[model samples]
Target chain A: MSKNLHTSAPDTDTAIDRNVPEFPVAQDSDEQNYFKTNQPPSYLDQLHKSTKEFIQFHKDQGKGRKVVLVTSGGTTVPLENNTVRFIDNFSAGTRGATSAEYFLENGYAVIFLHREFSLLPYSRHYSHTTNCFLDYMTEINGELRIDPKYSETMHKVYKKYNDARDQNLLLLLPFTTVNQYLFSLREISKLLNLVGGRALFYLAAAVSDFFLPHSKLPEHKIQAQDHNGGKLVVNLDPVPKFLRRLVDSWAPGSLITSFKLETDKSILIKKSNQALDRYNHQLVIGNLLQTRKKEVVFVTKDPKIEPEWFRLSDEEVEKGVDIESLIIPAVIKVHEDWIKNHE
Target chain B: MSKNLHTSAPDTDTAIDRNVPEFPVAQDSDEQNYFKTNQPPSYLDQLHKSTKEFIQFHKDQGKGRKVVLVTSGGTTVPLENNTVRFIDNFSAGTRGATSAEYFLENGYAVIFLHREFSLLPYSRHYSHTTNCFLDYMTEINGELRIDPKYSETMHKVYKKYNDARDQNLLLLLPFTTVNQYLFSLREISKLLNLVGGRALFYLAAAVSDFFLPHSKLPEHKIQAQDHNGGKLVVNLDPVPKFLRRLVDSWAPGSLITSFKLETDKSILIKKSNQALDRYNHQLVIGNLLQTRKKEVVFVTKDPKIEPEWFRLSDEEVEKGVDIESLIIPAVIKVHEDWIKNHE
Candidate 1:
């Protein structure tokens, strides 16, 4: 068994060895050689490349341009079953969306995170645009017939939608629950990290405070059963205050604006002040919804400048209210003053 | 012919003389009736009928009940053109509707004067209902859904649309702008006068402050023109404060409740108190809508018991925490306490 030449032979010195020699591998290769030698790039790689290119292009254009992030509408909350609930409000997105466009018209990139039934047109021509889609499953009406001059607006929106569909951007995370809204806010906060200091976040979303605390996502579609004759007694949990958290966690230098809609003049002013104090926000826009005219009182922490309230007549408050003329100038002025004083 | 027929003519002459007086008297039979034979019923008739019915119904049911009138939603203003202008809000009729139902549940007859887009279900089951029709058109999915429940709610609304061939309520009065809202409110006030003091009025309509200062109803239908690509700048005039007018015009001892929603707590209380002072209202429901849960503070002009604030949790709030609970109970308690103390 050890020495038969015809069968197998250990040639004189061949033995079981502990140490074995291995050949050196190449770390780098030319493009042509690599293509020939390796597998094709994955879909993820192409997506990453495209996203990087888009980001780089935007970054280049965004230089010297202020950026605004406007959150609009009411968040929906999902129930135990597949059925969803919403913290519905009568916000036509008139104030926020209009303000956003005003900001964009004044040379700012707007990232609009809007909820369903928004009356403001998310035009693409406003330079840079991005939407945090939340109501994809919810059906929307046909495209609105807008002025043809707003072609750029249309193009930008189409591009954003296409990119979202292609997974070039993060697909909108749908939330119908308060907890989900909180989660979405947290996720948005993480995304804010990439925005750096050039970001101006306007939190105008009417987030609900109470949601089904014990709701559980169904593993499968549950059969429609009228539980207690469709009279549901939902036990609601207190939602975590995101605005309070945003002010607490974010850097103090960040410019944040909060809105307060009130009926009483004095109460609205006081609330605006409290908002400034609680959030450390640069400005608080307070308005009374009961009145026809969109009169807003801007409150800031600045001591030397008395808090000024600007009243926009109904005509002035119409769709074309120039944000630059009315409120933004004050905001910019305050910013300039703050910089001057701090420096 | 004269002599022989004279005898027969004498009878004819006598008959003719009876018809025509010697002094050329006027025809008594043909005389225009200065006094109306069938006069329409008056407030006295209504009072008699109501009293009889009230006594009979109480005798049959063996119970005494209070009556409440709740007015919810926005009113419209009439323009110079056939089209009307609306001053509306995003109220879903949740608060006012729920409070009306609460009154009903508490064995009180409710007169619900609701505007368009109200969530209150229209049924004959209600003790007495009156729907105040405002000339506002709401377009949903490109199709108009006119407020059809108008007839079930009010008699005046029935008279407005009853003659029209088109059953569509939108066609009855075309609301083009905010001016129409003022006109509508004026008409509603006239109707309110008919309701009398046995009713409690709740002013929950979010009325607009400014109206189209100059709007003319076109002799013919104004062809829809895209004015400067639909960028029309409308001039607005200030609308008269209806709540104040309502407070002044309402019958004495009528329990009136006004609402004020604010973002600041201290301001809300102060404003609510001021509302009490200005309007001399029995109670003011002050709510803060910053959070999802509607925590409302009720303020009354109770000299003995100090103003108290109650915080409802999310669940309780969502369960439709109504001002009626506080209102009805407090009203009953105050009346009872007054009786006991006076006795």
Candidate 2:
């Protein structure tokens, strides 16, 4: 792949083509040094700083602690002309959020990289907490008047939120769009490296495959009427497969799981197998689109046991069943069994 | 599947089993009266009402128009305890909603069955058109600061929305779950039947595969608790393939299009071909997960011509390119070209 960099500085452009090693040596005097000079820190920078501090504090407290990284939601694609639009998907980010809760319950340190506009209750911030309560009350009342069955479901959700509040184990890094997801994942991976190899990555985000390859930062707003009757087209370059690459590049021999949804049974198996084969994943949970409850087939590289399919019933489905039921036990069994066999 | 209808009725020692034809008819006055007076309408009856109303309204206009139904979003699984949780993908419902706009723009009456919490803006109601001077000022200021490229893209979205508004050709059915989606699809299908095949169905939604079977509705609010430290197991039955069934049962000859997102080149071809084989769809568009822009391979069943792949550029990605560019033109060209050749 050619290194195509876009820049506006004329002198630097010439230097860039020459591939000068001392590119950073010449600094333009007019260019305001945002980082060098003391200025009020941006919200995002502050967030990063705080997160770093928290990790250090935790590291000081202990070793051999498990840190799980959970990523959720869909990424955004920038159309040509710099305007951004989101790729469409059916994910409300529910399963990812729920799984995060399960991880926290099991006493793992969590770093959640979530998407924008997720339906999951992310933070215990006062406003969000209040909204949750209101949602709970409204659901309770609505259920009471409507079918009692619906009411029962709402009650379970209410209880889950309450429990989450008590646990207080969530850390949220919210974003929208595919680029944001990629960047956040990379940033979190770096943080994990800083903290050591205790990181476990659960890639649950649904990333968009396409995006505008070239985008110009707009200085002014353009009107809808300006581009009348003219052809406007975007050339999309393929996005890098970050999840597959992450497992390969960052965390070797660490627990990594990926999800694949298929409409066909044979295809689902094929894809799950493919995920495991390509990524060296410990487990790949596959589900079909025909049903709402998860009936997953677990695929592992370990040759001792045959692949197992676990089906959830209606009763079990409503109880907010954790993927951990399958994930935890399988992981534990794999470790224990492997130890026994190897020893 | 065994027919087991358990009806709840007061004053009966046991639930009413409708499946047993030879069971003694217990004429409990309270139960019999309740069943007689307060029974909900049948699925078919509800279907008929919605279909008749839609068809009659369209026919009364005498526009000689076609109607298309586009269902978008993920469905939920209702557990036995009557609690419902969403089993969703990362779709924001943009394609479906945008396609609805396109159909309306081209003078087709559209019934858009959208899932809950989609980011796409619905057809604007008159009430939302505020004429505040401050709003205009804010808009102008926002436009002034727009990036040129982004402004261009915004112009297109605005133009499309305006054109759709002027055309007044969209109808919406907001939905959130698979059951609701199925119910709505069936209703629209009936309406299309009434229209004498002037309807096209787009199976664009990322519908989930598994659903809760035989879950009871909750009568009261349930508290959240971790399942007791015993292994919690669930059993899931396979859900019937509704999309495949729709293609087979309802509209055999209607123009159909489907999508397949693949991670690898080989699988992309395999899945695209499989979709065509299973549903006999007119067109199947395959996209790769690594592609940044919409790089699609179009496949058809015709033996003479091979499939074509369109590689879009970054510029084109910004203008919100049409899926029909690959689907509609190919469909029209194939049918037309085939007719000429045959003649």
* Tens-digit per-residue lDDT, A222-284, candidate 1: 112211121112222334345655655633444677777654454567657765665566788
Worst 10 residues of 2 chain B by lDDT: B125-134
Query: Each model's DockQ?
Result: 0.01, 0.01
lDDT of 2 at B305: 56
lDDT of 2 at B163: 55
Off by more than 4 A, model 2? A1-47, A50-115, A119-343, B1-63, B80-84, B121-159, B162-167, B216-234, B318-343
Q: What DockQ results for candidate 2?
A: 0.01
Candidate 2, residue B294: the lDDT equals 67
Candidate 2 lDDT over residue span A197-295, tens digit each: 455667777665444333332211111112112211222333445555556555554566677755556556655665676656577777664542557
Number of the top candidate by TM-score?
A: 2
Top candidate on lDDT is: 2
Task: Output the lDDT of residue B290, model 2.
Answer: 56
TM-score of chain B of each: 0.52, 0.65
lDDT over C-alpha atoms for residue A178 of model 2: 57
